[model samples]
Target chain A: MVAQSTGADAKNPIQVIERMMKLLDVLSYYHDPVSLKQLALETGLHPSTAHRILAAMGATGFVERGEPGSYQLGIRLLELGNLVKSRINIRDSALPLMQRLHQEIGESVNLGVRQGDEIVYVERTSSGRSSVRVVHLVGARAPLHVTAVGKLFLLEDGLPALREYAKRTGLPGLTPNSLTSLPALSRELDKVRRHGVAFDNEEIEQGLRCIAAPIRDDSGDLVAGLSVSAPAERHSANWAPLVKQTADDISAAIGYVKPDQPAARR
Target chain B: MVAQSTGADAKNPIQVIERMMKLLDVLSYYHDPVSLKQLALETGLHPSTAHRILAAMGATGFVERGEPGSYQLGIRLLELGNLVKSRINIRDSALPLMQRLHQEIGESVNLGVRQGDEIVYVERTSSGRSSVRVVHLVGARAPLHVTAVGKLFLLEDGLPALREYAKRTGLPGLTPNSLTSLPALSRELDKVRRHGVAFDNEEIEQGLRCIAAPIRDDSGDLVAGLSVSAPAERHSANWAPLVKQTADDISAAIGYVKPDQPAARR
Candidate 1:
């Protein structure tokens, strides 16, 4: 489903649902419990409106009141989420491939798919090194302009959709190296499409460098992207071929046939 | 927030929301993709009504349409679920302790909390052995009358609530050892309350056994339960005390301070 806010059309029932969805969005952003006042400020809703919305959500177990006045997403949402994740066959299918990539690169491996204006991580595997900490959780989202997986999906969607997406979500810089203009990003996507790979040169995070490739379904539609991320010092130009080959292997395993290859080759 | 349905009684907007919640209840039962016809049959609604409800849910990104008109909970739900799981401090607080128990006992450890009539697993750690394929994922639910963790939560909520829960959800036999009558289950809960531990001797699954303890908050009210499950062949009489001690240790680690300590210790 598309994640967009309904406009201020009073005749739309979806508008009411949009307001409710906004409340959830505000709650989801906080790492700790949030108070009603803070929620009102964040959502630009009046205190009473936010309070009533939160109460309705809490009653249905969509949001929970924790530690007296603070609120967080409730357990019911988690149950629903678990059901969703289980139904997505990609998670189980890609896990072994992700593990192998992690072993080969000695870095964090991620699998992500485009959802609306952002890329959502579907699975991640990290090398067992005490010094490294993986920042991307299974359900975390990143902007399309700033991440390797995002660029991979953008390139796979082709030029027209990529131009539209860049127009809509404007390529804001997350780091100094991140492409902040649509023209620059368009040129980058063209390069990615030619090479069948994308790179994040300390764009999403200051010290992190990532190389990614697109994963396609049996229909040749871009279904997801796979990447290996490590500190920039460790990820030299030599790692690009390895990451692209691993991604192709994963794509083949998931029933994606190359353009001229026979089905029997799989 | 509670997980139980309040049923259909269209009194006001809240009741209308309750009707909508019934649709969610039907979706929550199956992890696999379900058809609109199946949802209509399960919820006792007309096909047209089910179609509209599913469409609304799908549009809102709460449910996703899978292959050939089948429906499943969407990734948006998982994003929300990850938010809820992150705020659940008890899961992180109990993980190291659960890991220790799993290592000591060579069993699968589970951490769960009561969500209305069911226990939803918040965290799980497997033995990671090739021989065992215990496939309980995080966020899976179990009935309150069957599993050891479920029984622990029931007992922690006190005997009166336990009786009411059993009366409402009827203790049907899941396996030969499941307690099928109110009186028998009430007696079992009483013993668990007195001794601070609960056991599942093939009550949920025929060849599995589990031991669980309640985790209490600062107010001494039970917030969750921790348990370990193993094959019934591993449950000799000699292992009872070891299981009980492990449960007690986890309970203590999660802030279940004993009341009857000596004055010097206090």
Candidate 2:
């Protein structure tokens, strides 16, 4: 019966669903409630189309209407997000190691995974003293070009995919140090590939700096990024090796044997 | 236009919305991917109806189809959940205090908030020892009758509301210590209300114990619960006062003044 209905009205239903997905993606970018006009503009949907989709979503508690035309991501999302986060085993496995790194370095340590064109923080340990706030809250997302962990993921994409990503996000700059040109970003990524480490020197935020290294799974696939973040004044060249070592330790714990190491006979 | 459309098809649309909400709620309960048959049976929807709704949701990235008919909560929910979690000020304010308490007591500390009929763990600090493998992961949910923090919320509900909750959840028991009868739950809550603390002596899981106290906002509304959890052998009667004090300290940090304290001179 459903297949028959889809055969008759496939075009309209799919279009509506695509528009709704775009509207939801736009809402996810915000940390506060967003107006319908703003959501429409961001999603490139007409106000009426966005409104219709949002009304249906609101009815299901997927979106909450605030004040009048404003909307926010609902509590149901939080409940679901927690469920997703809990199911990801790497987070539980990596947290104690991340905590030890934070304790030793007295800097924020973060665990992030590549999600589409961005990096989503799955876990983090906060640096207690920095008055300059780093907004890498757990579950926070940042574009690949603007963060240390993101840079490592971008480096894995090679130049062709990197150019496509640069085109998609418009190489948006958050600070003067942000790499906005293709040549600059490519050069930075080259350094990252060679050194197995990435750095954000006041790139995302003016006073914040971060150092990141790759975490691999049993298959030796780059599964996550581990980073230590600190204020620019406190940031040191010394932390890079330590960050890379901790990332390697986590990678080994997860069953990745280093490529250069001799395999032991069973 | 939407209002006019709703006027024309009010009943069906609202029913669809209710069914979709029920499907999502059911999916939230299992950390692993669930099958279409299981979801249909659980939600009391026809398999075809469930499939059609899930396909639309999958198009929106609200659900992910895996291994044919199996479905899992999507990453979009995690993205949205993070946004909601970041907006709540209490989680940020409570973390440092919770850290301090964990450091002092060497027990697992959890931060949870009441969401409908269950408690959702928003944040937690894990104990370094005890291989008991507590399943209370972040974003994990437990019924209100089974946890110490949950009992605090039930205590706030008063006797009439408590009776309603007991009926709704059937006073389900996880262990022999669990309150499976309304009379027993009411008696436990009476002690909680009087003493300003709640205890779960292996009610949720055998060989585990928890002590919890309420956290309030400036307006004196109980907003969250802070608790310490440990194994039965390691659990101490002496920790109750300390847990209550730590909870009070967190509450104070979030602007809750004790009722007994005189108002500060402006």
Pick by TM-score: which candidate is best?
Answer: 1
- Report the number of the highest-lDDT candidate: 2
TM-scores, in order shown?
A: 0.39, 0.38
Docking class of 1: incorrect
Report candidate 2's fraction of native contacts: 0.47
Q: Local error of candidate 2 at B121, Å?
A: 23
Worst 10 residues of 1 chain A by lDDT: A1-10
The residue-level lDDT of candidate 2 at B57 comes to 80
Tens-digit lDDT track for model 1 on A1-266?
33233344334334345566667777777767899998877777777767876776677777778666688777667656655554556666688878877777777888999898899998889556627765688899999889988998777677788778877877778899999887888898888888888988889989988888888754467888888787878876677787788777766544455666523110
Report backbone clashes per prediction: 0, 0
**Residue pairs with backbone overlap in model 2:** none
Report the lDDT of model 1 for residue A197.
86
Identify the runs in model 1 with alpha carbons over 4 angstroms from their true place: A1-13, A44-46, A67-69, A91-266, B1-13, B44-49, B67-69, B91-266
**Candidate 1: pairs in clash:** none
Candidate 2 is scored at a TM of 0.38
Candidate 1 residue B59 Cα shift, in angstroms, is 2.8
